[model samples]
Structure formats: structure tokens, C-alpha cells
Target: MVTLFDLIVSGFVALVVLPLAVSSLVAGSPPPPPNMFLAKYYLAEPRLMLASNLFLLAVCATAIQRLATHFGVLSEPVSRSLDIWISVPFVVLLLAFLGLFIKAILTVRRANRAA
Candidate 1:
């Protein structure tokens, strides 16, 4: 009884959201003293911590929603809304990570060309 909407949501989560979450979690680790670049610009510890917590919440929400669906607990509208709401932090984190990634790339290229 999976609908097109369900398929699309699942695909988006699997393809994009999950990767971002895992990467953010990994990158969020405290950077070494010599690697201030990561701490200051790319993946600040505070941001990573927040993103990690949000990622946990997102996982829990998804699991709960799935279990509810299986047991016929939540309605379609409620489930849809939950999915959309849970995606907000992920999307924001994704944008932030992309911005930092681009900046890091450009900085590296510039440095390489200068040498």
C-alpha cells in the first residue's frame, strides 16, 4: 500500500538525507589543534554537536513513523507532516555543509595554484 509520496520521501531520505547525516556526524568530531581549519570554518564542534543530536532525532522520528505505519497508528496527513518537519534540520545542515565544502575547495585550489 505504499503511495508515490511514500516512495519519493523514502528515496530522498535514503539518497540524500542519510548521507548528509552520517557525514556531518563524522565531520563533527573535534578537530586536532593543528587542524584549526576544521574547527573554525568547515565543521565547528558546536555545529556538529547540534547536527548530531538532530540527526538522532530524525532517525528516531523515522523509526517511530515506520512502526506507526505498520501498526496503522498514524493517519496519512500526520505522517506526511512529520516527514516534512523532520527534514528541515537535515536540509539546513546540508546547505551549511555544502557552503563550507565549496569554500574549502576554493581555498585549497587557490593555495595549490599559488605554490
Candidate 2:
């Protein structure tokens, strides 16, 4: 018999895994292809993906912090500083990813027109 905790853990795992799997499928191809258009695959969208992963990490950290708070534990002031540091990278990566996504779309469209 699965306890409530077991079910909750399974649900959390599914929530995390399903989106990643879907994103990979949507990406359609691996990164590092010789063709620029083909590189639009999930692997190639590193910046965007990294931002997403980092966001998830931040969420997990917040949850952990809350749990600690509930337990009357004090976290260091460093977590706020760490959050600021991570935000900078996330913004940079997100912008880079958006630029690449636009470029990839244009490249694909051009190829289709040429063919």
C-alpha cells in the first residue's frame, strides 16, 4: 500500500519529469548540428533551458527555505545574495535564448523558401 507521502512524492516527480520530457520532444532535434536550423533543437536552446532549470532550482530552494522556517531554523543572508546572482544569469540566458530562437525561425523559413 502506498502511503500518502509516497503518492505525494510520486506526484512531484511526475510534475518535474513530464515538462522536461515534453520540452525535449518539442525541441525535435539535438543541438550541435552543422545546420543552423537543425540546431534549434532542445540541446541547442541551452540558454533558454538553463534559465528554466535555474528557475526550477530557485523554486525548490524557496520551498526548502520555507520548510526550514517552519522548523524555526534560520537560513543565512547569503541565500538572498545567491538569488540575486542567479537572477542575472537567468536574465542573460533568457535573452540569449530568445535571440537564438528568433534567428532559428528565420533561418528555417529562408531554407523552406529556397527549397
Candidate 3:
């Protein structure tokens, strides 16, 4: 029973999650760009980017774990609908991570299969 409040919470959480996730992913694995693009844009510090990327991964992992607790998927007593206030954001972020993971895996599979 997702209400307007739930929708709002989910949207905000997704917005935050996607940017951090995508930026970190890009910074970590910089694909070689074309002649013009390569020289123009490059990671300023690969080490820092890697560190920040690891930090983001840790934070997201903890968040998703908390979300699992909210879902009781990790084992806990299910509370009442009042938990929706918390569940909305947790579930949204968890789903976002799941979606990203799935997409990344699929992309890898496709590339592997192609090669």
C-alpha cells in the first residue's frame, strides 16, 4: 500500500543513490574514450576516486542491510504500517542497488557473450 508519501520518499532516495553509484562506478573504471574526449576529460585522481568509490560501496552496503532489516528479509519481527515511514526510503534504495547490480551483471554478460 504505497501512498503519496511513500512515492515521494522513494523518488528522493533513488535520486541520491543513482548519482553517487554512477559517478563512483565511472571513476573506478574509466573506459578509454575517443581522441577528443580522452584528453578533455579524465579522472583527476584515480587513487582518490578508488577510495571514494570504496567508501560509497561500504555506505550503500550498510544502507541496504538496514533496508533488509526493515523488510524482515534478514530476519526480524514485522512491525505495523507505521514502519512504512522508514521502509519507503530503505526499500527504494535497496531496489535501486538491486537494479544497478542487475544491469551491470547483464551488461557484463552481454559483453562476454559478444566476445
Candidate 3 wrongly placed segments (more than 4 Å)? 1-23, 26-45, 76-115
The global C-alpha lDDT for each of the candidates, from Candidate 1 onward, is 0.61, 0.54, 0.50
Instruction: Kindly list the per-residue Cα lDDT of model 2 for residues 2-53, writing each as its tens digit.
Output: 3567545555644675466457546642345556554554343455454455
Cα lDDT tens digits, model 1, 4-105, are 777567656656766765665666644446556554433333344444445554665575676566558888888889788877866776666566556666
TM per candidate comes to 0.46, 0.44, 0.36
Which ten contiguous residues of candidate 3 have the minimum total lDDT?
Answer: 38-47
Deviating ranges (above 4 Å) for candidate 2:
1-76
Candidate 1's clash total is 0
In candidate 3, how many Å is residue 23 off?
6.2
- For candidate 2, the 10 contiguous residues with the lowest summed lDDT are 62-71
Q: Report the error of model 1 at residue 21, Å.
A: 6.9
Better of 2 and 3 by TM-score: 2
Clashing pairs in 1: none
Q: Write the candidate numbers in order of decreasing TM-score.
A: 1, 2, 3
